[model samples]
Target: MDNLRKELLRPSAESKQEVSGKVVSYFAILLIGGLVGTILIFLTVKGIALFTGNHFSLREFLTGVNWQPGHHHFGALPMITTSFSVTVFSGLVALPLALVVAIAITEMLPSRVYKFFQPVIELLVGIPSVVYGYLGLTVIVPQLRQMFGGTGFGILAATCVLFLMILPTMTSMTIDSLRAVPQSYRQASTGLGATRWQTISRVILPSAKSGILTAMVFGMARAFGEALAVQMVIGNTTVMPKGVMESAATLTSVLTTGIGNTVMGTAANNALWSLALILLIMSLAFNLLIRLVSRKGVR
Candidate 1:
C-alpha cells in the first residue's frame, strides 16, 4: 500500500514539474525574441555610424538645404518639406471624407448599407500600391499636364494620389472605431438635450479619438514610406518645388537613383546611405511616438 501511494505521488509531482517547465519556456522565448530585436536595431545604428564616420549632428541635418551626395552636401530641407506637405494635405483630404462616410455607414445607415459597402472597402484594400502609382502616372499626370504647364508631374499630383491611398485606411479605422462607441453613451448624450451634431462632435468622437489619431498616424507613415506612386508622379526635381506644380524628388527616390546607382566608393553612395539613415530615423521616430502616445495617453 505504501509503495502504491509513493508511485501515485511521484507522477503528480512530475506532471506539475513539466507544466512549470513549459511556462518558463514560454517566458524564455519572449525574452529571447525581445533581445534579438534590440540587438539587431542597435547593431544597425552602430554599423551605420562606423561605416560613415560622419558625426551624427542634428543641427547640420536640420538646417542644411543642399542634399547632393557627390559633393558631400547632405541638406534635406526639400525632401522633408515635400514629404510632410504631401502627407498632411493627403490626410486632410481623406480624414473628413472618411469620418463622414464612417458616420453615414455606422450611425445613420442600416446594417444593409454596411454589408453592401464592406465589400467595396475590402476591394479597395486589395488593390496593390504599384497599381495606384501607375494610375497616378497615367491618369493624374495627363490631367495635370493639360492645365499645369504641361509637366504633368508635380507635388499636386502626388498629393491627390496620396489622398486616395490614405482614404481607405482612415475610413476603415474610423468606421471600426465609430461603430465600437457604446450605444449607451450616444443615448445618454441625446437625453442630455444635446443635438445630434453636438453629441457626435463631443461624446462620440472623444471616445474614438485615440483610434482616429492612430488612423491618421498610420496614414502618414504609409504616405511617408510610399516610394513607387509618389516617385512616379512627383517630377523628381532635386530643387524644392515651386508651389504644387513643380517636380520634386523624395528621399527614397534620391537614395535609389543617385550616384549610388553604380560603383560604390563615391560621395553619392555615402550620401545615399546617409539619406537612408535619415529616413530610417524618421520612420523609427514616428513608430516610437505612436507607442509613447498609446502608453501615456495622447496629450
Candidate 2:
C-alpha cells in the first residue's frame, strides 16, 4: 500500500514540475518582451521630439553637416559618415585576417593545439573595451603620429583599434561555422580526388557562407556600436573628415561626449536621442539580417 501510494504520487509530482518549468519559461519570455518594448517606446518618443517639438527639418538633420549645439546647428551627416566608414573599414581589415586564422585553427591545427588556443580567443573577447582603447591611445596613436602627422586621432586609428576588438569575435564565429560543415562533406570532396586545400576552399567555405556572413554582420554591429574604444581614439571633432587621417566624431563618440553636458528636454538633448534612435534602428537591422541569413541557411 505504501509503495502503491508513492507510485500514484510520482506522476502528479512530475506533472507539477513540468507545469512549473513552463511557467518560469513563459515569465522569462514576457519579461524580455516587456523590457524591449519599453526601450523602443522611450527611444522613439525622445528621438522624434527634436523634429516634432522643436520643428527641426528632418531632411536637414539627415543631410546637414553642421553639429554645433550651441548655435542650434544639428546636422548629423558627418557623424553618420564617420560611423559607417569606421565600421566598414574595420570589418574589411579584420574579416580576411579572421578567416585565415579561423581556418588555420579549425582545419590545420591539431585537436590539442586548437583546444589550447580556444581559451586565448575567448580571453581576447573578454578583455575590457577601455583596455583596448588605452592601448590604441598609447601605442597606435604614437606610431601614427610618427608615421603621418596630426594628433593621430582619426578614422584610421579608430579602425585599427576596432579591427583588433572585433577580430576575436569574427575568428571564433568563423571557426565554429567552418567546423559545423559535415565531416562527410569533406570526406566526399577528398574522395572525389580534391586536395585538402581544394576541399576547404570549394566545399567547406561555400557551405559555411551563411554562417560567415552572419559572423561578419555581428562584427559590423559590434564595430558600429562601440563607443569607449572609438571615443578614445577618434578625435571627437564635429567637422566632416576629408581623409582617413583626419580627426572626426562618430555618432557614438558624440553621444558619449555630449549627453552628460546638455540639459534634458532641450533640442540639444533631443538631437542626441535622435542619434540613439539611429543606432537602435541599425542594431535591429543587423539582427534582422542575421535572422534572414540563418533562415536561408536552414532552407
Candidate 3:
C-alpha cells in the first residue's frame, strides 16, 4: 500500500511541475506583448495630439520646405530630404568596406591573425557616440572645409562620421552570418572543382544573402536615427541639400534642436512629435523588410 502511494504521488509531482512551466511561459509572453502594445499606443496618441491641439495641417507639415516656427511655417521637406540623403550615402559608403573586412576575417586571414584583431575591431562598437562626434568635429570637419570650401559641416561630413559608426556593426553582423554557413557547403563546392574564391562567391555568399541584407538594413537604420553625432557635424542648416558638400539638417537633428526650446502643447512641439512619428514608421518599415527577406531566404 505504501509503495502504491509513492507511485501515485510521483505522477502528481510531475504534473505540477509541467503546469508551473506553462504558467511561467504564458506570463512572460503576456508581459512582452503588453510592453510593446503600450509603446505603440503612446506614440500614436502623442502624435495625433499634435494635429488636434495645434491645428497643424498634415499636408503642410509633410510638404512645406520652410521650418521657421517664428514665421508660423512648419514645412519639414528639407529635413526629410537631408536625413534620407545622409542615410543612403552613408550606407553606400560603409556596406562594401564592411563586406570586405568580414570576408577577410573569415576566409583570407589566418585564424591567429583573426583572433588577435577581432577584439580590436569590436572595440569600435564600445566607443561612445559623443567621442565619434568630437573626433569628426575636430578632425573631419576642418579637413572637409579646407578641401571643399563649404561650412565643412555638411552631408559629406555627416556621411563620413556615420560610415565609421556603422562599419563595426555591419562587419560584425556579416562575419557572424558568414560563419553560420554550413561547412559542408564549402566542402561540396571544393569537391566539385571550385576554387576558394569561387566557393565563397557562388555558394557561401548566396546562402548567407539574407543575413548580409539584414546587416545592411541594420546599418541604414543606425544611420537614419543617429542624432548627436551627425548633428555635431552636419552644419544643421535647415535647407534642402543641393550637393554632397552642402550643410543640411536631418529629422533627428531638428527634433533635438527644437524640442528643448519649444513649449509643450505648442505647434512647434507638436511638429517635433510628428517627426518622431515619422521615425517610428520608418523603423517599422525596415523591420518588415528584414522579415520578408528572411522568409524568402528560408524558402
| TM-score per model over all chains | 0.83, 0.96, 0.93
lDDT of candidate 2 over 1-299, digit per residue (tens): 99998887776867889999999999999999999999999999999999999999999999999999999999999999999999999999999999999889888889887899899999999999999999999999999989998889999999999999999999999999999999999999989999989999999999999999889999999999999999999999999989999999999999999999999999999999999999999999999999999899889
Candidate 2 deviant stretches above 4 angstroms: 1-11
Compared with the true structure, what per-residue lDDT tens digits does model 3 show for residues 1-299?
99998877776767889999999999999999999999888888777765787778889888989888877788889998998898999998899998998989988888887788679878998888888999999999999989989689999999999999999999998988899999999989999999999999999999999999989989899899999999999988898788988889999999889989898877777778888888888989888988888888788
Report how far off residue 283 is in candidate 3 (Å): 0.9
Those runs of model 3 whose alpha carbons end farther than 4 Å from true positions after fitting are: 1-18
lDDT of 2: 0.95
**Who wins the TM-score comparison?**
2
Write down the lDDT of every candidate, Cα atoms only.
0.78, 0.95, 0.89
The digit string of per-residue lDDT tens for model 1 on 1-299 reads 99988877776767889999999999999999999789657546543651456653556655677766556666677887888788888888888899899988987889999999988987886688889989999899998898776688888999989888888888898899888888999999999999988988999988888777777787778888787788889988777767888888877666556743645545445556556766777788778866765555345
By lDDT, the best candidate is: 2
Kindly provide the TM-score of model 3 when superposed on the true structure, using C-alpha atoms: 0.93
Q: Report how far residue 25 has shifted in candidate 1, in Å.
A: 7.5
